[model samples]
Target: MLQNEQEYIRILRSRLEGTMPHEELDDYLSDYREHFRIGKANGKTDGELWQSLGSPDNVAREIRVTHLVKKAEGNRSARNIFHAAFATLGLGLFNLVFVLVPFILLVVMLLMIFIVGVLFAIIGPVAFVFSLLQGGLPAFSSWISPLIGFFFCTGMTTFGLLMVIGDYYLARFFYHVGIQYLKWNISVITGTECSA
Candidate 1:
């Protein structure tokens, strides 16, 4: 049916009711309400306004994806990010290569960095102990100085810790960027750029 402002608002509210909080739902609906109000004030009919706004279902989907991305950003969970990415991927075929490939590569890169950091963290202590033993054994001490080995082990441990910390920040940065890109993608894909 989707002929008038009330019907448009009702459909959006019903479709998004369970997925979004009441306050947030009201906030989004208000935008449409304003669009309708302004259009009517300018002498446009309800049908014309509704048509220009596009389908309520499509609008609902865009809002849903945007909300999911925001939720993932706030909570920072694997499940949340997966849901957000999956939802965005559903928007268009281009996302299959653009979104999915980059996501996979970034995840693999982060995991590899984490594993390397853990290996270094473990090996650093063992190396430190071995270096101390070298001082006690004159033959081993001739091969490498205990003091030099101690510094090297310390440097490895410090670098590993920094790598782990840096990875965390980098993940957060990418997550933020991903969310913004998804928002833009949804806007463009759905032809709701003005509303977005």
Candidate 2:
């Protein structure tokens, strides 16, 4: 069958239309057009150029992932990052193990840490207040002196606060590292290394 430039562009545009911004879609379409024009000028038929470029579906998938990753990097929003990660998964089944598994683990681990931190932060203060209001300690509390209990509770509160703060920094660090890793992974997968 004759695979013409228009047919390729149509497939690419249809795949990308709603997923990408108009200007970006136009830019990609124009780039493909230029490539075809140049190829023809160099004595390559549209079919030859199309064959070299691979299937339009595969090309569109790679382009979607690259664009999403860049948008995530630039915007630095949860929605953007999630979108990028999800788009990366579309690259292949390999990503289900590599990308999706790690992404799920990180999110679950972070959420668990945050929950523990918040629980400690709340429970420590509440226990301290109960100890004060009761004038004496309960059986479990009686194992330690009031002074020791106070110190322990204070330490717990401090630890919780630090955990929460540390978690924030860790998340930020992970975001930066994850973005770079995604870019690299996409490059390796799509055969298009980002200059940035």
Best by TM-score: 2
Tens digit per residue, CA lDDT, model 1, 30-118: 99999999999999999988888889988898898898889879999876676677677675566877778899999999989988987
Q: lDDT tens digits, residues 1-196, model 2?
A: 4599999999999878766678989999999999999999999999999999999999998888888888789999876777777677665676878889999999899888888888888877787878777753554555666787677788888888888988899899999989988887765444343556
lDDT leader: 2
**Residue 101 in candidate 1 has what lDDT?**
86
How many residue pairs clash in each candidate at the backbone level? 0, 0
Question: What TM-score, over all chains together, does every model reach?
Answer: 0.50, 0.56
RMSD of each: 13.7, 11.8
Superposed by TM-score, candidate 1 places the C-alpha of residue 12 at a distance from the truth, in angstroms, of 7.7
Which residue window of length 10 is worst by lDDT in model 1? 187-196
The TM-score measured for candidate 1 stands at: 0.50
Candidate 2 whole-model C-alpha lDDT, 0 to 1: 0.82
The residue pairs that clash in candidate 2, if any, are: none
